[model samples]
Target: MNAYCFTYLFTINYLVVSVIEQMTDARQSYSIAIKNICQSFKESVEKVESIKKDSDTNNNNEILYNFWHVFIEKFQNEAELHENVIQETKAKVVTPLQCIVKHRRQQISRLKAFRTSTDYTLKECAEKVNELQSNYAEMYRIHREILQTKAIKDLLNAHNSYVLQLHMTNAMKAYYHKFVLPQLMQEFEGIVRENIIGFVQIFEYFCSIHTNMFDQLICNINGVQLKVREVSPDSVVSVIVHNLNKNQNPTHWQLIEYLSPDCDCPEILCSNQIIVDNLVKVELRDKFSELKRQFAELSSFMQQNVNIVDTLKTLEKRFDFDTQTEHINLNMHDDIYRKENEIRKAKIALAGIEVQESSNRYATHQEMHSHSSR
Candidate 1:
């Protein structure tokens, strides 16, 4: 019976030590994996920051778009792998450790009760020996039963699923908020800058065309006329204001005279201004059409990019990663607290048994009885 008792303690103590060691190793591995994930995430953020810097400096839309596409593909793949690791750790490592801690605590309580028993007789001891053997078998069965319980299985599934979702939420927050959103905004600004530059160039091109057509019209009329007189700035301004106030669209020649107050030009009648405006309009029609087409294309592209930014904002709000992470952390803290308390209680019980064993020696029932009688 004493031998059986020692055997039970040895087996249980070995199991407890093994479980503790396994838990320690598993936790260490998980910590390293989490560290690696954080480091990789930092690296990815830095890469994106560098890309933004490049886009700002170089203003290369093609390069920025291409890099963004490639980076997203790679980042998503890595995030999926990290998510798998989180789920796997929760299911395979966390679940088993929780079960083992529970079962070990129950075993410890039973062992302590049996060892501290004060009643001993030859018949009773024999029955106790049989009971001890039954207990050992029951311990194994209980372990298996606890593992097969619906509650344990449910806990395992729920924890794993939650962990996976938490990881995914975190990934989305990192990718979209930190990475994608900033880049999209930067790119949109760059696009706007390019559009402004394009519009300025188009305005300059049209101004040059109108000036050349004005010069040609003036020269043609002057070649046939016998006299040419310098037009006064006051006269030009009065004509422009009068024509504009009358809701008459100024001819290209009138527009040029209005634009260039310092220019020396011959005075022109409204009918010639109308003819010059018609010629200039015909020359500019194709350029204006091309500018409108380009403007529409650019506007559509800008709108599409704007939509992406808005969509990302919606996802950023929806994910609420910080709250999800906080919830997971709280649950983890609770689990750790429970497990640590269970281990502390088991250790105290084991220490008590050790003290009893060392102080009394492995005395047999007869020896214990003699000592008690004395």
Candidate 2:
């Protein structure tokens, strides 16, 4: 019985050892299969991640290109409008003042295309944005300088007009006092003696021509005032006051009161001629000084506004390029993060397979030992 039991136990042990070996082989095969599947999965995920990254990069680049194109188009339109206006003004006016406007318009047109182009790569866009911004800054500086020039020209024109008017008025006064008044006195004496109506006809014609000249001057001055008002209302007031004060002649006041009825003042009596002269001078000086001060204030305010416009243009240039680059970088970063996560997941799956293989080996070994004991 002991011999039989030993044989049976030995046979059972042999069968158990075979089963354990088969289980180990099967577990090893399964492990290999899992490993291969894990490896394939990892490779597939890598390919997918790579494709996703490529697609994301392509999409980002396309968006950036489109955005740049749109920005360039906007600038182009603005530049075109400025150019057209400048050209039209130059053709109509033919003034040195219009030359500066034309130059700025040309500059705008030259730089408009730099805002976008498919030929430029991502790196080139950054460089171009900076380049364009610098150009724009220079243009702004030139524009301000030109505006200063226009102001100077306007001042010179006003001075010339004042001088011409003064000469003409003095000439007319001299002609009337030296020639016209003596002629009129002689004609009146003759008319009284001979009863002639010729002097009346001559006087009426002379008065009509004088009235026409006066009207013409008034119209010219009014036109100048209108233009000055359009450009800077405060400055027009200053110019008017300056001219009036610089020439304190009674004729100037008479002209002013005649042209602008609102400035009419009632005659005032003074104790002394010197005191009246001094008072007139003081009033004219004070009025002109006030006008000049107000003009200076308005001019300074306009300059500040121009500076603000320049600052905004600078900011726009910076934002246009920066926004596109940042968006592309952000997309790239997201793609990289996504790829990392995919790799991490693949590694985790591989590790789980390894754990299963170890468990199968341990179970097979335990079965073998138990059969040997039985």
Candidate 3:
């Protein structure tokens, strides 16, 4: 190989080394994130277990113990699934990535060192071979072949070894590209499916536990509703009357008047009462507008509710009427059909036409024409 090839290789290596260092940093950060998630998960599980254990000791804690008992079991299943994902990620991606980084750095350094030395030797070997070839005719013309010449044999062996080393490096690069890289990438790419989709499935199961708890509570509520009668607002007045004491004074509490301030004026030099009157009038006008706006809002809200209630009542009445009149409507339809059939029979009689009850089939237009002609 040429000297420039080695120089280019070193340049590429320098650029790639920076990138690999960044990858290493990213891997370390990713590892820390996984650790944090696992640690937080562990603490949460411990808290749940602790709560469950404490609740179990209290014999009267029905809902708490039962809830945690089911919760802990569900959490265990979720945790196990989460742990599997973590292990898979570490095995398939994280650890493999780490090894790739180490192996890559080693290979880059080794290849550069070996190739640089081999290229230097290659230049010298080419010069040696050229010199020997150039002097071969003169040396043979002068003397016979030299015996015990170690230099020629050593030079050839060194060239062969260097060439073999280059070939081996190429083969190693090919194998990695074909097999190792593709396999690692295939495993690494499934990070989404293994972690994201797997976590989704696990979390879906987790949420179902809460759904089941809510369903059970709803069932309890429905049971209570079924056993009890609905209370009416009008019954509150009757209840109050029933509980009232006859001996107690009717007006127990009175409105306490806070002393209103008087104007700082002498008796002989008093101002007109128009100050208080005008202020009261303006305040009352403002209060009236504010109260009217509030009342309008409430009125609109109440009207909307009333309209909804009325529509619902109308629907109820319509449903009830349909149920009650269903048979009558059916009977009326039957009578109308009966009268229409009778009228058709009378018309047939007036027209002096008779249909055969024995034959099921009626004559076609062509057959009727033929019969009429006959």
Q: Candidate 2, which segments miss by more than 4 Å at Cα?
A: 1-277, 321-374
Q: How accurate is candidate 3 locally (lDDT)?
A: 0.33
| Order of models, best lDDT first | 1, 3, 2
Question: Against the true structure, what is each candidate's TM-score?
Answer: 0.20, 0.15, 0.21
Worst 10 residues of 1 by lDDT: 252-261
Model 3 lDDT, residue 175, Cα: 38
Give Cα distance to truth, residue 170, candidate 2, Å: 24
lDDT tens per residue, model 2, 275-371? 1122233443453355356445545554554565555444444542232354443344334333332332233223323333333344346556767
lDDT values, one for every candidate = 0.34, 0.31, 0.33
Clashing pairs in 3: none
lDDT for residue 192 in candidate 1, whole number 0-100: 32
* Model 1 lDDT at residue 38: 41
Instruction: Rank candidates, TM-score, best first.
Output: 3, 1, 2
What does candidate 1's lDDT look like per residue over 139-190, in tens digits? 4344444554554343333322222222223333333334333443343233
